[model samples]
Target chain A: MATDSKQFDFGFRNGRLRVAWYALLAVLLLVGGYAMWLRLQGGMRSTNLTSITPWGAWVAFYIYFVGLSAGAFLVSTLANVFGIERLHRVDRDALFAAIVSMVVALLFVWTDLGRMDRMWHPFAWRQVTSALSWEVHAYVAYIFVLMTELYFSMRYDLARVAERGTGLRARLAGLLTLGRRQLTDESREADRTWLKRAGIVGIPLAIFMVHGGTGVLFAVSKARPYWNSGLFPVIFIISAVLSGTALVMLLYVLRTRLFDGERVDRDILDRLATLLAAFVVVDVALTAIEALIAIVSLHPHEVETWRLILFGEMSWSFWWFMVGMGWVFPLVLVSKREWRRTPWLMAVAGLSVVIGIIAVRFNIVVPPQIRPVMEGLPHGSYFPSAVEWATSVGMMAVGLLLYTIGAELLPLTPLDGGDH
Target chain B: MSSNDAMPGVPDTPDRAQLDAMVDAEQADPRAELEDVDFSTELGVAMAEDAKAVSRGEITSEEYWQRYDDLAAEEFGEVYHETPNPAVDHDTAQTIEDDVAESLSCTVGSMASIAESLEEPAGDSEGASEDGEDDDHRWGMVIDLQKCVGCDSCSVACKAENRTPPGVSYNVVMEEEHGEFPNVQRTNVPRPCMQCENPPCVQVCPVSATYKMDNGVVNVDYDRCIGCRYCMIACPYGARYFDFGENYDDEVEGAGEITSPEYGVDRGEREPKKSPVGNVRKCHFCHHRLNRGEEPACVETCVGDARNMGDLDDPDSEVAEMAASTRAMQLKEGEGTDPNVYYLE
Candidate 1:
């Protein structure tokens, strides 16, 4: 029942379950709000960032969510662009996830700026060589494109739900539909065509401008050898595909099976898990090649940074979380023919991969920066302060809260993928 | 009383045997050392022996000089003019000048005369002013390795002169030891901003808050800087640093009252998390000091006289001359930054 975007006939019943969900969301909002308050009051001093390690947990989360959003958007294209009816079930969910993650990412980066008040400068004074300046423009444009595409995808559903209901959802749907009461085959065909075009155009934009460009933010830094390479942005794209696939898979299972306690199709679960397993292999392969290139070059500066990532203080993040749970464990669960058929195992694999993606983001940001740019200068080390951790958790909670409220108030799930 | 107190003992001169051994051991070429002086060993010995008499209250210094005058006239009766003494101090300043000149590609005689004329180096394409003027005085420094004792007075003086807040040092000393323990080479590299002709810092600054000045110094416009700190990551030398609104409030006295007039802006009072407080900062070759016809704080306070600052465009300047020396090298030439700072290894 919760697997689709268009609402079904069943209402938000089961008062106790609704209350429990709302309570969890409310607690998250309250606690996360307090942490956010501390951050605003204290400035960057509330974080563990130093002059040496300028970017910390916030920057990590900023990129992590960006990957997830780009990943989710691209996953939606599998249905809208490629006409994959099997994946149609998650299209609206994917779009909503994309929008929410982008919001979380933008906020994280906005606050991470040294002069948060002067955030307008990057827009006002655009320099040609500055990738960061270009990023602002691209991110804003990407958001507009996402919202427009999402509106097109949901217009018919809104019109349908509005005709049948007379409560908050109906009123909101009417206002959103702009008073267009008629629904016909011609209009529905036009909506499908527009959606297909939007998805097609958005594919390259999501792959290159949004996620790959974010990778370029670090790759262009000649000072940090770890990130300066042609392969970096490519790795970012592949990993985005990987994490995006995992996120959609996780959300699908939670929405359908866990929260709603409904049965899901075995074919969808197996195929999604298989896609995730394949992405993990590709992600790990790219990482191995990157490591091999760095290790064999024997450049002390480059080697030291790699060592910091592989065996230094936060080595466990790479060795355990990213490799063991993120890749190997997920790979084992999904690739095994017997386990792949089990819906719970597929969900577990999806959950492990989504958590591991966060670990990937941290390793990418922290380790290279931890090694001093020069030999004698103080090497950086960072563990996000309690406030930083809380704020990040709060932001994640906020993402969930938004998802929950959005799920309830809007037509997020329908029986026929909102087509009829 | 003064003479007696000065030379109370050792009144009697050493005997011939003792003098000869002392001469053989310590004065292998006594005459060479003695040439500039009045050449009278007898008069010198008599004066030394009489010093003991004076110390014993046998005679005064005045009386001693008066008694030795006839011998003193023969001992020190020569007018000497300054001349190169290769037998003693082998390398004079003139010789160094000639050697450095000889090594340069410029005509040997021309290089010697270059001391008086201001001209640019042979290959000076990089670091031209934004206005595309190459004739402007591009300030530069040359750190001499032999002279740099690495006392880090330069770093301290930079802090005091710039009045940078905590964690905002514009200059730093990087030290490392290489080779085997028995034959280890300890090297100290005192790093300031490279002030590259094609600075990556200036290139990456999204707001263009940081820029290369007409004088070839890279400066950050604190008022305009958004504190993105992209420059810090782009800098190959790690010279650019972020001002994370940290202060020496607890560590230093009256910390907030101290702030530099950087970029010639009177940003009064280092408020907690203000313009420069949140902006990126770096060495500007002490442009504020330069406007006042003074060298950088690091150059002014270097105990070893290791750092030299002058107009690289002015060939007559010491920095220009040293920049042309064979030992002169810049850090990270592969980055193609073309740093104005030179290191004489």
Candidate 2:
């Protein structure tokens, strides 16, 4: 038993290492914030954005985090709403990750808006026709739902922390509880009842309204024939699920390792890897259908966009990042029975999937803009400037920092009871 | 009570007393008063009563008027004698003449009236006479591609005339080569804004920045353009270009010295990021030259007699006849854009 505990404690030292990582992230975020300040001082001219290519890195990153947020949230909802008990261990962490990812997504989009001062117009006017206008409303609603769901899931634990009444954690827990305490069996039962109901409702809202709606945003733009597909939204939702599962698996392994806690359920991680692999297959299939329809139509604009994505300037991203790193590497890692048990190997696979999805988002945004609307008009050539890259890196660091802090402060992991 | 007060159009008299006695007898017998009374006075009173009846919704106006006419015929031997006075007709004629005289003093009002009058007459007498002449002649163009060398002189002349900033081309020549390589023959198509007969750009403009003129030229109101660049996308010819805050200061010695009052608006000097600088601009068919009673710079400088300018309604005019030519066709005929600028092969 002692040897087993010692094995579990491998490379796990609490507080010190956690504090160091947090400090590093904090520094990176500050640097990014400074870069963002520089960007605001100097207008779009400071960036390499031109009339030909109006959107660039900020837009790419905006969609990337949106995908990640949607993906992570959906995975957590699967365990909570659908009674997927195997995923329960990582579900709360997924929820926290989602909230952080969404915050980062909003920051990227906020920076991209032409007149950031008039950011209130979308909410104020509420243009029913614009997909972007609808997305703003959905994002707000989704964030509220996430927070509520997180609160319910953490309610019993928060009450425990409030009862203990020791450090900052207890104070925060008390504040979170809003002076309400429910430590009895009946009250816990009531809390569980509310959480179950909220989770059940949240499942469809997350899938159809939030993530699927985002897919509809791109799919509905008839100007872009490549994006105009009925299957695109389905693909988006599946990819969300895939990315969400992968994120949860990685976070679970990494967080457990950092906290000097018991080993994460290897069986659950392996199962998540399998689920992710399945989703990747579906995603690849849908993508194939999308490309095939475009090719068969033989429309000049569609053909040109396809050529640019497949064989032209952006092919490296498609072939190397999306197919190679995103699909093949993860598939190979998850498929091997021996490798499936290894936590670090699975983490590497999950990390690759996350990076690959970012490439996918970049490919989605930049390729379509490269081709001009008119035939004779000049085609756009775009490479994100240093400032754009720096701002993106900074925003990502901020997201990571938020997630880390939340994980450290809160009892994001499940308590040592209520197991069936 | 008093018989003298009862008579029609009489203050107090014996006739009133007599009429009153007759009215009393008519009240008793009804037919007695009808027979005794003079029909002319009765008829006039009846006509007045009929008008009142119509006003009261008792009888239709047509029936009332008809009955009045019959009564007048019986009383005066002809219905024409009681016809409404011809003075109303005379007054109406005089008012119409006054209105015409008043309106003719203003240029737009006069032009509107003249246009309304000329619609039918112009169609009838296409080549009859050119009586109405003004210093401000409406200029238009017809490019016959058969004679065009595709030398791009017209494009050069236009660039020179306008001194357009970079990325803003007022005119362009599109070349199409037909058949596969070995058997291929080239066709040169010089395109300016169709100045479309029914310009889609003018229709979709939210600000009314672009509009069709009476002289068949589709013109842009530069000052009104919000620089939204919607019109640039709407044009089928890709004729419209956005002025992306560029300047001709580097390319030409004094290009920015004086701005062309192209739309007849005297914008003083071309400045960076100014109204027209950011707005969408296209060929106005040279409105400035048209105001000066000269052809467009492109037409005037064409080496070949390839360009023709005339009223399309006049069949005798070169444009009207050429527009009907077997060799002529508008670009993108399938689109139903109805381009005013026709090409002759």
Candidate 3:
């Protein structure tokens, strides 16, 4: 890879691009916020959420962002705890993205809650039986752990900036360090120790409590025979890993490009792509098994739900978007050893997986709802209203804005060290 | 206070010497209290005394009665007739009359009133009693598949009676045309929310929002539902529907003006923000009409009289007898929903 001198002009970084991106994000946020306000005012009437199809785009986005958050955190943990040195360059950015993605996921869920005003009720009056209630607690705990982990990971960089004390970055860095700026060996060791512990604890929590628990939420619903299966949670865990690895790979490439910095480690990106491919393979296998069981049982409700997923009006989303684009294409792109070696090709594969995961979340939520439970009952048909689409875009923009702001203000990338 | 007062059967004005003699005799023998001048007169006195003792709790009333009964037996030599107490007999008759009057008033005011009165005097005869029994009919429903012309009038009537919204239909006729060409036969199965005895909707509802009632109707508690839509997915019969806050305002002049008083709860005027909007709703067997002593809207408005409503528990009732017929069947019986609504082919 050629060292491009033009890419290292950090001082003369364009104010124009920054302003444009920020303005676009701000506009999306405003529009989405306004739609949310409308949704609150009108209740569920503003959207096309019918008795037949209760969940919609908001729920799909909720799980999508959750998968991204969980995925990013897992990747960061791989570098920090497992000592995957090649990934160390993008580790800080991965952690920051994980935190931001989680925040975004929380925001999506906040919007999805029927009684957003009583959102605090889950925290206050915890229902032990509700999977959603447990998820609320797990998410809160995970966010806290993420923030602590990020703080520790950035401690040495923060102290260095504070020692310089020449600009706004120094002042912010000084405050972030909480007035402790020794940057001693002992302090470094302590930071590393805490980061390792947080990562170690967070790994299982992210897999089992946060993401896998989300799968359990739907799986335990015996009412929806389509979602009622033991494999559902396991599939969720696998998909989360898939999405998380893909998200980090995409983020590393995009951030490196945006900053006009040195080339991202292609070997690590390849490894991440391989991991994502493996997860996709597992996810596809689990889905096949689920379908086989459902079909073989000849359970009418389950059969109908499966038919709706495979052959119903919205079956195109399942066939093309989810199975074809999300799984097959990404798998093929990453599986090719030569193509995986190229950073841009790897980025494309990662992007494909990310897009594919979104479709996966959608397919999980919608198909079962469209089929009516009884023969004579009217079948539900749903399409997101303008407000739903706008709000979703706004949510994505907000996530991006958070990530951008964090990246700019914090030491999210490696600084002058190959061995750190 | 003196020794003269202690003398038994002696006058209070007895002389001091005579009282002294009586006291001496009392001290000599405790059994002397029973001793008397004439044996036969004393026996009669003792019998009278025993009777008094019995009344005062000296012996059980049964013993007193038995002693009297024995004396009567001896006197009459098994021919002594003890007539039944007229006061007791009169009290019994009065109590019965009061009970009859109370029952009559209640029956007259309710559906069973005419039946109770018609059967009241016919208690002595089995034939007339059977005739009167038919008056108090327990309401049920039997949907005939053969006669249902697939007009959807039953569904419309149900909507009018139940005030179900656009997406929440209490009754829907599913038309299935089976076979090919010349062998084809069209069957219109009007499905109400099954009102299943073992409803999966009720089973899967986390908060017990939807439940079965004593009158064999499945009802939804709008207030408790969290809009999870789990019941809708669980129901094999596809009987449950979510209230998505839809209205017929664009189509009807005042569709939202009158909301269904489902389960006899009159929630006046359908509105967007009200409950049952974001809740799961299902057929309650036209609970409001049933409460008012009328058949379900579907059964009443079936122009062909194909829908019969009666008590299935009563073996002789039309619904029960029809349900027993070989032609009668229920939808998705293999799923074990045990639907109360029977369809006759």
Q: Write the per-residue lDDT of candidate 2 for residues B268-306, one digit (tens) a residue.
A: 888654557656788877766555446788888899879
Highest-scoring model, TM-score: 1
Off by over 4 Å in 2: A1-16, A417-420, B1-345
Could you give candidate 3's per-residue lDDT for residues B1-345 as a string of tens digits? 457557797645778998899898767442354465323445445566777897798887577666665564564453334433222233322222445767564332222345565555434233322222323433457898888999999989987877777777867888777899999988888888777777766665545556666667676766566665656656766666666677888989998898866765667888776776767777777766655556788888998889988788889677999999999998878767777789898
From the highest TM-score down, the ranking of the candidates is: 1, 3, 2
For candidate 1, the per-residue lDDT at A415 reads 46
lDDT of 1 by residue, A68-92 (tens): 9999999888888997778877887
Query: At residue B98, what lDDT does model 1 achieve?
Result: 60
- At residue A273, candidate 1 shows an lDDT of 84
User: What proportion of the real contacts between chains A and B does each prediction keep?
Assistant: 0.64, 0.01, 0.30
Residue A345, model 2: lDDT of 91
User: What CA root-mean-square deviation does each model show from the true structure?
Assistant: 11.9, 21.8, 20.8
DockQ of each: 0.44, 0.03, 0.16
Cα lDDT of model 3 by residue, A1-420, tens digit = 222333222221467878888898899999988987888787767778876677888888888888888888988988889998888877887888888888888888777655445456455544456576678889999999888888888888788766753566667888998777877989989998999999999998999999988888788766567888999888887887888888888877777766645576677777887887888889899989989999898988788888878888878888888888789888888878877777787788788888888888988888777766555556778888988888888888889888887777666775543355
Better of 1 and 3 by lDDT: 1
TM-score per candidate, chains pooled: 0.80, 0.64, 0.70
Tens-digit per-residue lDDT, A183-300, candidate 2: 7778777766777777777777778877787777667655456666898888778777777778887887898777646676778877888888898898888888888988899987
Query: What is the DockQ (computed on Cα atoms) for candidate 3?
Result: 0.16
Alpha-carbon lDDT of model 3: 0.75
Clash counts for the predictions, in order: 7, 0, 9
Chain B, per-candidate TM-score: 0.62, 0.58, 0.60
Cα lDDT for residue A164, candidate 3? 54
